[model samples]
Target chain A: MPAGEICIIVPCYNEQENIKNVIDDIIDNTPSKEKWTVLVVNDCSIDSTGFEANSTGKADVLDLPCNLGIGGAVQAGLKYAARYNYDYAVKFDGDGQHLAKNIETFIQELKSDKADVVVGSRFCTKHNGFKSTFMRQVGIKYFQWLIKLLTGKTFTDSTSGFRAYNKKALKFMSKHYPAFDYPEPEEIILLNKNKFRIMEIPCEMRKRQGGVSCLSSNRAVYYMIKVSFAILMAAARKPEE
Target chain B: MSAIQIISITGSLFFILAIIQAIRLKRLKEAYALLWLITGFIFLVISCWQGAIDIIADLFGIVYAPAILFLFMLVSAIIVLFQYSIILSKQNDQIKNLTQELALLKNKAQGCSKDLPNKES
Candidate 1:
């Protein structure tokens, strides 16, 4: 078992249909003896996501006053972890796409101390999983190439939401996290530029259980352009000592 | 002065006075009001002198003197608007931080209250 307190930060925006099941899956899969807390950040969901998570009686729920989008919600979770002094924090999507079994794998990777952050990549292995739409896959590929060009680092799943971070990484990330506009690829550039060790592990993912994706087909061009500019800016940013 | 100069001078004076009054009433911060005050003063000078715009346009090799004034106003507007955008972006970040902090603090408070043993029990 991995030692030290771990926080599973689940940022949910109107995931009422799958939030409970996602939280339950995490609780059921992870070890019972180890110190781990599941934090559900409800980003002012119109649905009863907050109430459902609270009723579970097994997760800590933070009800944001207004919608801060995914970036703000995830940052809030990391801020909570940093304030409470947690050893590790893992970002798990609340739409039930991420697997709970991989949470242990992330903790184990962090324990080995080789990497400061671990990204769960679906394309890292040959395992059969929900590979996303063709258009999105093309977008992800473009981002992967762009990141490589800017940071000289190759990430198979550049936009993977399933990620884990240690104390140092989590504290640093909470402060600089960007808004909901394709922040994952930009984050890779940020982490790489800052000299943080980022590792990617193969993990299987399912299709999102409920709710529509924030990124729509119409906005794909805008998303790509915006995210590319953001990645370039992140690359040019000065690293904190 | 021509009739048009009289009208222009009156407008500039009114603009300057309005900015001053807003500053006096604390409706506008002095730092931000300074630009408007300076622009109004420039307008008053150009209107009163009449030849000042012609001189400026000639210096810039502009064929049309009135076009120079329009260009000047456009540039000033852009600069002022750009500065406001910067301030707005900063305020936006601050608001985001505050919201996150409020949520976290509320959660902590609830946890603390829940931990307290029931007095009635």
Candidate 2:
């Protein structure tokens, strides 16, 4: 692999405590021994996330002027990768739920040309069962059903943020990515409509190392309603060629 | 002086106020704000002259006026989203082209430096 073949994008918002550890893990665990770059997109964090990410020296940091939510942060990362001609780009959470060890599987799947976008699914393999509140499980199931209905494809984890994209997928997503909370489901539909291939790879998820889970019960309910309506609206619109 | 007339007049006034505010604030470029403006104006006109709106609705054979309003709102939302997507696509293309050009220039510069002889010698 030549220099800059693969780029890992980590979107951080006030995850100052875990950002350094996450980047260190990625630097240590990246496979292929190939030249890969990490891009830490700081979404206007009030904490030291931006400063810490820059201090680590393991990744390049792009600090957004204003907080644009997770969707906007991830989209900014994809746009950066796409603009720079990166062969592949992966989105890793800054809160540390995503394991760096599993990233190799995603890259290998992309290299095999199996899919343009490979999602890391906790449900795909029995290695580790997803540990979350029962309410979250219910919400996930509902979103999965909605994704299948809207996109005509069954996705085990529609809301997983650990995903990899080839150049083509990155290009498409950089343009039409959603701009709200829990945007993965709507993004899947948008990708499907654009005729990009998508696949799921099994991976384990851990609880956040520090800080609280951003999704409260109230927020989860609101997310469910908002995302459902957004997906319905997106489906009604014409698909982009 | 009927209820419909009062509603129409009020809607019209609100519509004008929104337009003037949008123009003053320079928010006309935002599609969401533009949609609101258009919706407001449509309501204003329709309310001010219910007879004309009824005639138009009858021509379309739409019995309930509120149903038509709901349909218009849905359509407006879809259009705004579609327009946003188009703008995003164009921006993506421009950025890609610019990056490619920069990469090419960097390669040329590297080649030129490599061909030069060592001045230290």
Candidate 3:
């Protein structure tokens, strides 16, 4: 079998301070022989994120007309991956949190033919990295328990944005993934409902280098309720063939 | 006629006229307008025949006659609102698809334009 084409989708919103380093890290760490291309999806940032990404000359930049939130931005990248017929797609956050070195593990897991989707879990191993704030950790644990209750599978990091998908997984998600607000936890339930094999590997993550997180402490309660309802809705929804 | 009857008839007439006027101005699509037009016609019938609510409520074994009308209005509002939510969801999906497609096509165009300089060189 031939080596497959891979598209690393970096969804950014006002990450002008960190987009360049993120893109460069991805480019530098990518295997030399692998056919890899970085695609920076600028989610209608008010800053010069789009311009910064364009000047990098190493990745393609897609400027959305309006702010589509993280879910919509990632979905846009998946749609592009589907349109271009990429064999694999990886979602790497542009906030300087996710490390590029871990992408190799995702690719290896995909090549191993064990899982259709690979999620990078920070809590899977005892690593001394910048785990999110205490409040966020509590919220993450809540989702972790919720997913376990719903899917009968344990996920240490239910809200980790670092993930990779094969063509089969990406195609289904491109069309059916929730386009509303945050989709990380809901998407895990969606994939499980559709019988997609999901595997998690340990990966290190850093704190955000710039820009405010969309989920502030004040919005945490709302985020939990919205995402929990969405997860339940996804569980009850019939799988689209 | 009772004062309530006169008020009901006037209200129903205005409602029906507003529906027609909306259709004329192309603000309401005929398909959706049909539901509201039917509702207005029912209201006019009930208003004109003072005993209509009494008879219908009796048939349904409802003790209070006016409560039946309120129930009818509530059910109608719910159905109309539910239909609107469905339409809103479909349009939202379309808008999202269009936005993504536009961005992807523009990226492709930029890629082609970037290659032109290399080709010339």
Candidate 4:
């Protein structure tokens, strides 16, 4: 096959304050002129996230009629990538935590033909960026332990949303990804069951440029328990193949 | 009539009338209306023939029969709720798909409207 299309999927929910800068950053940092398309999924924001995204005209805005959470928003973008038959689909947060500068690294890594899904990890290297608070770090470690116990594979930063997916991964997620809550850790179990390869690339993550994170201190605990059950349920069932 | 009898009779009649009204006004789909009708019919029969509850409860080896009647009603309600949960899950999947499709179509249309592909130099 020849060179393929790369679609950077930005799932936005009330990120009007940071969305324009996010789009501009991606456009400024991308190496290719027309190969990469910034597809932003505005998740029915009550604010002007949709308007800001559309006004920039640099990204293709997919305005959802109803809010479907992060999974639905991201999956909507994935479905678009699958429909248009893009070779690579990358998920970047709309709150500006994810930097566009590392996208070239992701593309280069995907080109290396190693992992079907490439996770941009904040804990992969000593020179990491903004490694959250102490409690959040402990929560990350707990998930790391749980994943190792269940799948016998170690994954740091299981909840990080900055990641890249090739066509095969994008297609799979477009059809069967969970549409309710956070799907990062759940996706690991799914990929493990289905026998897909995942690789991690070191990424520099920053604090959010604007808006509040969905996971609070209290909500983080609930997130861990909920994701644990979801992982267990997924692992308990046999793979469809 | 006893207090329990009056309550059961009134409850069952209310359910039946509610189902009928919902179907008549097109508030409930015919398929779903059938489920409500079945529940109301079961309640009506149990209220009218109280001995039937004893026989069924005795068959299940429970000494307290009326307790079983309430338990049965609870189970039926739970099953209906489970059915609705399944329906909601399916509808959720469909809505996600439709939203994704609509977004893609809208984007493509915008692109086309901006510049007709064939007209490009």
Candidate 5:
């Protein structure tokens, strides 16, 4: 792939109702580039997500045989992009939380060589729409503090899945991404350890267009414990020079 | 032997036995087993000759004997974490490379389909 080629990766579990609309929005928003492509990694979706994604001419459907969690699914997409030699890769949420309009900003940042990874942060700037619940806000803040302590960088929205990565970042993440849920914090630490530059771009997120969030009240506690342990373990380890 | 010596010897023997069992069951890898074995031997030696450890601890500028043990535990944890990170990063690289190769092969196969005959029945 050339220097400016970008691939958008969307990981879907059971977004049958929203998959088609998401794909259409992505297609409508993507600029005319010879090498730009959309890769929808279907994480063994029991719904018609795979069928709907295949129907969309804009995306390349990569269906996993078994359900890997969101982390695994995103890793799969990164692997595809890296293997294809794309210059940049962006991860977009399958549930429509990420807006297609913000993709241009990500591309512009990458093109200008501002940072290796550009993250779309909801809390970085004031927006009138879609405030996360108070509990969720607290959870995000705790993770953000942990990330800052571990990585020495303050990230406003550590859990936001909307982000773009340059080729080197893509290669690094593809090689060493977390396998379970809530990989964002761990990935940020890993990237920082490797001396990768990460920048936050302000973007608005919409409510989900389809199925409910995978993170329930019970799962939130589990996520906190697991992520905290993972971060501590990661912090203890020495990074390769 | 005095009562204190007898109790220390018995405790050291029990610790050594547990370490051996762990090694046998493969719960402890060889590198880790070496550390455990060394620590167990040190305990066994101290239990047999407490005066020797006292002299060494004094020479090392250590007042409390347990401080050495705590230091060893902290160092071992750090080493284990370092080794684990190496393994995890290597595994991640392999997974990424494999997935990328699979995607490329799929893309190549799709491209080749156009060159083949339409039907071969």
Candidate 6:
């Protein structure tokens, strides 16, 4: 965001082959590599993901003893950002899908105070990158419509993890995040309820270079139903004071 | 007495023995075992002296005495489960806090390692 410290969090599981590539890409593409540091939350990977990330000597690796899933791992990273007094935090996937070149663009938006959170969207204008399967596209449309109906905010890619958070959002999420299922979907509701401004811009994403998507095969239906129900339930519940 | 009374008394007695064994083995905490101990005692008393429950049930306008026993059991089980749920929620919060702390500690440790002067240079 500003000229202050920024932490790029990479929450990965079983992604040993791609973690080094991710670190190199970030260092090569970040506008100011000196201002940014990479923090890899290893999410209790069963493989050598932690060792690979650590051996890179470019990113710090946090190896969790138990698998806390993607949301829990990312929250741990946020807490790290807050503890280190980082001015901004960005969530970058470790599967080599997210482009590090977009870091500058996200920083520009945050510096300009465009929004409290800047999300890298594949559908902000045109889907120029790797679009999900047709079924996933349908699921994305479902979330987009549901979010608009509930919070009156429109979103194209509701599940994109490539996002940047200002200090306020980072600090708040470091402690209080959606602890239940569907972290990304429930996050939209939580942010809206807490009055955090979220904006998305068009960005390109490559297909995973290593591991498979968690929602690759048959879990898509379950994810869609779970997130849809979670969004509706969040709308019904009163915002926590 | 009757075979039903004898069976119920022996069954409750065996349950009490099993619970004590579990507590002794450290499989169950004393705080949690207290409820089961009370439940076992209630069962032993009612099964031995069926009339006690009959009188208690009469006071509560419960026609069927054994039905009152089941109701009490159901209510107690729900309360116990709710207590465990509360404990679980607190543990979950603690786990999240510990995770955050561990990550921060690791980051600091890494920083220290990098800051160390190279000996081979």
Give, for candidate 5 chain A, the lowest lDDT window spanning 10 residues: A1-10
A100-198 in candidate 4: lDDT tens per residue? 998888877777888888898899888986758998899889889998999899898788899888888889988878677989988888887888788
lDDT of 1 by residue, A152-216 (tens): 78899989999999999999998888755568988888888888999999999999888877877
User: With candidate 3 superimposed using the best TM-score fit, by how many Å does residue B59's alpha carbon deviate from the native?
Assistant: 5.1
Instruction: Estimate, for each residue in B41-93, the C-alpha lDDT of model 5 and write its tens digit.
Output: 77788779878766877889999976766775588668767778987887765
Candidate 6 wrongly placed segments (more than 4 Å): A1-4, A179-181, A232-241, B13-27, B34-38, B41-86, B115-121
Better of 1 and 4 by DockQ: 1
Model 5, A1-241: lDDT tens per residue?
2123777899989999888888888877877653577778888789889878876655677777667688888988888778778888999999988998789889889879999999999988886376788999998999899888877789998889999999989998887777667788777777788888999989999999888788989888898899899888777878854
DockQ of each: 0.38, 0.08, 0.35, 0.34, 0.06, 0.25
Error of 6 at A18 (Å): 1.4
lDDT for each residue of candidate 1 in B1-121, tens digit (9 for 90 to 100): 7999999999999999999999999999999988888889989999999889989989989998899789979988998898899989888788789989999988887765432111110
Find the candidate with the highest DockQ and give its number: 1
Q: Order the candidates by DockQ, highest first — what do you get?
A: 1, 3, 4, 6, 2, 5
Question: Which candidate model has the greater TM-score, 1 or 5?
Answer: 1
Against the native chain B, each candidate's TM-score is 0.89, 0.61, 0.88, 0.85, 0.57, 0.87
lDDT for A88 in candidate 6 is: 90
* C-alpha lDDT of residue A217 in model 2: 73
Worst 10 residues of 5 chain B by lDDT: B112-121
Each model's C-alpha lDDT? Answer: 0.86, 0.78, 0.88, 0.84, 0.79, 0.82
Residue A84 error for model 4, in Å?
1.3
Evaluate candidate 2 and give its CAPRI docking class based on DockQ: incorrect
Top lDDT prediction, candidate number: 3
TM-score of candidate 4 to 2 decimals: 0.89
What does candidate 4's lDDT look like per residue over B36-79, in tens digits? 78889999998888889889987999888888877977988888
C-alpha positional error of residue A137 in candidate 1 after TM-score superposition, expressed in Å: 1.0
lDDT of 6 by residue, B1-121 (tens): 9999999999999999999999999999998888889888988999988899889998999887789878988987997888799889888878866876776676566566552111110
